[model samples]
Target: MTDQHAPVVVAARRTWIGTVGRGHHERTETDLAAAVLAATACDLRGLGNDTPTDDVVLGSCTGPGGNVARAAALAAGLGVGVPGLTVDRQCGSGLAAVIAAAQQVRAGDARLVLAGGTESASRAPQRAHRAPHGLTPYARAAFTPAPWADPDMGAAADALARRRGITRERQDAYAVRSHTLARAAHAAGRFGPESVPVGDRLDRDERARRLDPDVVGRLRAAFTPDGTVTAATASPVSDGAAVVAVVPESVRRDLRVPGLRVVATASVGCDPALPGWGPVPATRAVLDRAGWSVADLRAVEIVEAFAAQVLAMTDALGLDPLGGDERVCADGGALALGHPWGATGAVSVVRLFSRLVRAGAPAGARGLATAAVGGGTGVAALVEVVR
Candidate 1:
């Protein structure tokens, strides 16, 4: 194993079981955090380790009191002595936590770490929308607002599609494929292992359910009064959590854990006014850092925050249109499966894990994951399936 500090390599390396909150449980942020921690503890038990974690890193976009990580660690049965920190990077929080944790291990500051994210969009904080008063006339007119753009994400998606020549019909078609693949994967139990059952009432409530095309077609657009982007094509507000175990390569060898390796990871910022295009630069950065071409990737998982966003990146990356069977998010994406902000990153990582195991893909088989965030920030990670 490389030295903990001054290591030349850093990777996500290992993942534990991923847990989702009860779909119908109506859980609070605290409840969801506790549930995720419990699930992580159970996973650690499966790995046959009783040692206290060196550190805990939790991510939540709308965490209450901004202390979800510490609260979760304490609730999960970890000793009070264990340290924890919380992170919020909007939709990319989970991935950001993973990245930060891996860096710590690589930097030698930590050896054993628990990294994951949780969010209860159902319990999202309510705040009065306020406009900045200090901005100059030029800035006020030209600048986008916080929490969301002035016109909002849906509106931005609509404008982008129009500018990029993407049609409403094409976006709808992508949504249909998302539902179909999601339904098939659920039926076949592709997500059975990765998903943890939540709530005492509902034994299992996977968010990726089948959608009615007729009902989808009847829905009105959200952003544009007469635009094409509808709730059907956009990700739903949901509650969920996912956790990963990060350990040094040497420690992984000692544990004898299978399937451990890192490929590439990158983050980038773009024009906040045109936030929908954030993933394009982020994807390019990851590929450039890893010295791999798009064609070299076996599968891609671009967070479907919006249909047009995914469509825009597909074109930018020169990927096949969503209709093709070869494209990623084969089991649907945020649109059909739901996006729990903080948990979405881990959700994507878990999906990639399932895909690799199912295909029995060889080592070096590349998978790319990317997400666009609120502040024109985007993150991308590349993983190679290890055998």
Candidate 2:
């Protein structure tokens, strides 16, 4: 028999709602934060609710001093007393924030919360810092890897591609599919309602358009000397933000909003040397916790950190690389949408929500979302389509 007192709260309603960023160019960290907050506020208004949010969680991999979340909360018009937390788990930061928010809700810590992630790769470059001389000798020694090991994601991606037997042709094919799906979604106006357009100041949503065919050919190999991965095949360094509002099932029913539910979430760490494989263990952990199998999932959104990483994950999961059994990144992924580091994971969730709603899957149908991060850490979340 089921435990009647078990936490039965659902996700309520999660809307991609709004996104804002500069065109495919550099944007200020403050601007990105403000844009994200503004978009979130607009989305809240659309929900037609004035209830005070219990908490705010923001994800960001890079930003001005790593304070994007706090700044965003303030800019979004939340009260000064409203608690806010910023999370950074590399590429999975945003998704991690969402998972954390959901966990808090399930544990009865809060009845309602706002969760999302943002990134400004163009404005916030990868950072390297020196440890203070006050540290112990051993501490300093251990910190050596911090500076030297900060390799470009492209280089890491190239290495993984070659090691994992991913070929140039396969990468190109995936790129083509990503663009095709993104173009289709845009043309069909599927992403229109969710995308909050930036104003004349920004002129365009930096990552909201299709890739250029000519640019695809002109791209040079990235990372290794003869690496197959190119800028075209890899996700662009761009800026963007996404947010979701989570509430209790009772509140959902009262409000009459149909949404998704968080079933399980897991974060796992692996050897930093094999960063690309982090998702394998994370996936296993979530599935184990939920007692579900890959066969039970109707859709999956594995962050495309690189073509090779996606290829490796699919192979590890025993999924057909070319089959359509699971709608994997049915819309273009980071490769096409741009990887805003901390925002990518949350963005993946938004995509998952959009895809599930469109497919009209039955209640209890599962969706798996995963993202690989630096230092061999990955996060995965299992969500159910709530009836």
Candidate 3:
């Protein structure tokens, strides 16, 4: 918990993100996670720190009930000595798992931990709720109680966009920017080094295409007739996994590699009606704890579940939403990359590691990763590049 024993991320890696029913339809969550875990472990060994992993913690949203973390750990060949834990906090699952691992390391209970998230939307099994009379089928479980408002994510995003006065033009512009940057990043080979190929495809994404702004303007609203949210503005049903190896600063120094030192973390609750607002309070909390403001951040990454949702968060945080804030999602976000639910939170961190550490940013340059959960929650972590 102190400065000496602070947790740091020594290595990060992720599987190739694919569309739900297209590229990753045959691969399950366990498969995707195992691939990334093995890749991260290889990274550790490459750094000459092959200490056995103390735990394997993963987050999942739609996985079948059994301990999928343990299954994934075994699938990754972590052996029986390591235990596993699975966390489900809606979309914030991956970040929550990472923070949990960090806390364990801070407490001196774990020397090394591998943590991240996975999602297999295509492989999500059908479910039937058992009622008194018979069985009732449902698409997805509710995020709020029956008495509270729990609209579908798209509908809620559309409603929030309308309520917050975020017009269609702004939303479409953001979406186009995301696609353009993501495509450019991939073309420049910025993503290849961080990717762990899982299937036939190697270091390629199926969703990152530049959307014509003219065409984006003509598309109809998907949630409401007058709403601004559209297919292009929302993240797709995706499948992928991402993990980071967490250790104390001492271990990182011995490995002779720079890392992102955990400065502070915050997880907070907000109104369920507009879940996009979750990140606002969470980000503020971390900034407050770290005694830094938005202007001090060198880079920032937020899970782009929806264009309108992320815009709302950025707008509230006093960051320019259009293009002035290059530090925020410079390479793009889930909009173009695909939102694999539980895996999205971890993906944000990996992107930060790329933007900061991999890019040779000076030591102490701070970066942040934050996410908005579906069930009225936000999770965020503040880290700085450590030499």
Q: How many backbone clashes does candidate 2 have?
A: 0
Q: Write the per-residue lDDT of candidate 2 for residues 286-369, one digit (tens) a residue.
A: 999999998888888988878778888888888764566446887778776667777778777777777775457777778889
Model 2 bad stretches (over 4 Å): 1-50, 125-150, 201-219
Residue pairs whose backbone atoms clash in candidate 2:
none
Q: Write one digit per residue (lDDT tens) for candidate 1, span 1-387.
A: 233232111112112222234453377655665665676567656767554578888778765556888877887777798788888777888877777777787777887677767887666655443458643322112234655455456777887788788777778878887878877877786766666655555433345566777777788888888678887788777777777766666665555544435456777987775677878899899889879999998878877888888888898889865647465787787777777778788677667766774456786677887888775778888766544
Candidate 3 Cα deviation (angstroms), residue 291: 0.5
Clashes of 3: 0
Give per-residue CA lDDT, model 3, range 142-215, as digits (tens): 89997888988898899879878888899999999899999999999999878999978545877999698899
Cα lDDT over the full model 3: 0.90
Query: lDDT per model, in order?
Result: 0.69, 0.69, 0.90
| TM-scores of the models, in the order given | 0.85, 0.84, 0.98
Q: What is the lDDT of candidate 2?
A: 0.69
Give the worst 10-residue stretch by lDDT in candidate 1.
7-16
Error of 2 at 137 (Å): 23
* Ranking of all candidate structures by their TM-score, best first: 3, 1, 2
